[model samples]
Target: MTLRIHFTGEDLARTHIAPQPDVLWETMLSLYRLRRREQTLVFGEWKKTALGRVPGSVRMLTTLVPVRGYTVDFLTPRAEPGSVAGGMEALRRTTGERLRGDMAELLARHPGKRLPGWAERLAAGCPDALDALVGAVDGYFHACLSPYWPHVRAQVDRERARRARLLSAGGWEAVFSTLHPSARWSFPVLELSYPADHDIHLGGRGLLLQPSFFCRQTPITLRDPHLPPILVYPIEHDLDWARGQAPDRRTTLTGLLGATRTRVLETLAEGDCTTTELARRLGVPPSTASRQATTLREAGLVNSHRLGQAVLHTITDLGVAVLGGRWSGLIA
Candidate 1:
């Protein structure tokens, strides 16, 4: 299928909601500020004072990072295919029965129209074990972010009302009439979501509101910044690129693994280094360093070019993108 990608400038200009590029950048920065704060609370304070107080903060941090990384990885466009396929695969592997049940339910009576090709494939692939099949699908989605339909719907409703107020507030036309043209084109805000009954038509541009994070509810930093230098997108894009591969490479697990592997690749960007060198610098074990390197090589993060008796690793183009945050969801 041909996919229409709306780049930064053209999209915003067509919408006519022109705000200074600096203002837009600041808005993204604010979101990042919020995300950092949230991460601090979840990974730092809450874990230390609450959950970690009982279970152990280090373990909590370790577990949460992978989960957060998984969700972050799943949200980006590049990694989306993996999100779909890996989700299906994981459902098959983990909750085959539940997957089957959900699929049967979808086939019998879903809230929306007939299941899409991908969704149907997920259900029909494993015949008798409907529940398992369905569960995997359900779990894959739930694992990313709980479908906050209620939350998203509420936020969208509020935004719609607020927008109406803005339009009717009289300054609306004036704001657009003498607006800075660059402001409109330079910063595009694309909404990604799982397919829904309602679609948002911004000016004439159709936003791909895929099922992912509900921008309204997510802490602002999670929002996609129209431009880079202020926001990164590569990691997520890499994951998307990876997902577009054969089904074997899909999954949040792969995304998580890929992202972690990406980081290891970056460390090697300066030059090839031994696993021991990486472990010491990265503060991990020799085993972890070695395993991460192996994974990265497999995922095409880094390459092992033999140097004498020892093998040295260096980042590839993929590794550069990941380290630089060209793919938003992958590493960050």
Candidate 2:
């Protein structure tokens, strides 16, 4: 049986909460750096494991150059060599390279979903400036992945339909926002279908936004060799107290460890506390604390860096607003 689903572009646009272009740009760049850095840490940790070091040939092939063309490095050895171990290593390398490449391409092109008019205006102001900005923006796009993931899937499908059309499409950030009102970059609100039977996510009716990005075939098993299997974060009443320290609509934070993480943020709003201290207060292990902290830090919900030997976590202005639901106004 076939059933027709209807949803307008206006619907999808509304789900997005609009932040100023400059603010969005900065957030993207920061996210890019964090993702890159986090991946590197993960790679290093993996390398120390028995299965960590993939063969040198596989390693070379898997190494991807940022912003380079679509060619992945390590396909040859895996295809030709008759070594299963080598191929497995090659596949691991390939996974990282492919994920990074896709993410880079996504970032470089995604913002157009919200800022095509701004791009056009910039191009009109000074042609050379547009060229320079594209290069600068390309580097910055990586961080904004979480914010613009919805556009990444749609844009990719459009490109696959034809080759020349894809190359000449400028970038995702240049065209995705085409449906928006040119006068203001605000997006139309959108709805998402959370299907019970299958993994189909229909946003704005049939509009599919990055299905693969959300597809997780494997179980989430925490197996950190360096730390315990689980760590806990403290819970509090007001996470917003920390967020109140930042500007409105300046940052966006979204992640998976919601229940425990949200509670920790709410508790912190009362005042600052260390991970161990917070864990004691919340009744969770130290490992859970570490992972959630890392996730929160990457999402821009919390700020953390080395303070001597200890890492201090604090909610930023964006975090405060998110906990308080102050960002509802920015959504279409």
**RMSD in Å for model 2:** 22.2
Candidate 2 lDDT by residue in tens digits, 156-208: 22223211221134222222322212211223322122211112223443232
lDDT of 1 by residue, 273-302 (tens): 777788887888988898888878887767
Q: Each candidate's root-mean-square deviation in Å? A: 21.3, 22.2
The window of 10 residues in a row where model 2 has the poorest summed lDDT is: 228-237
For each candidate in turn, the TM-score is: 0.22, 0.23
Model 1: residues with Cα > 4 Å off, grouped in runs: 1-137, 140-148, 167-332
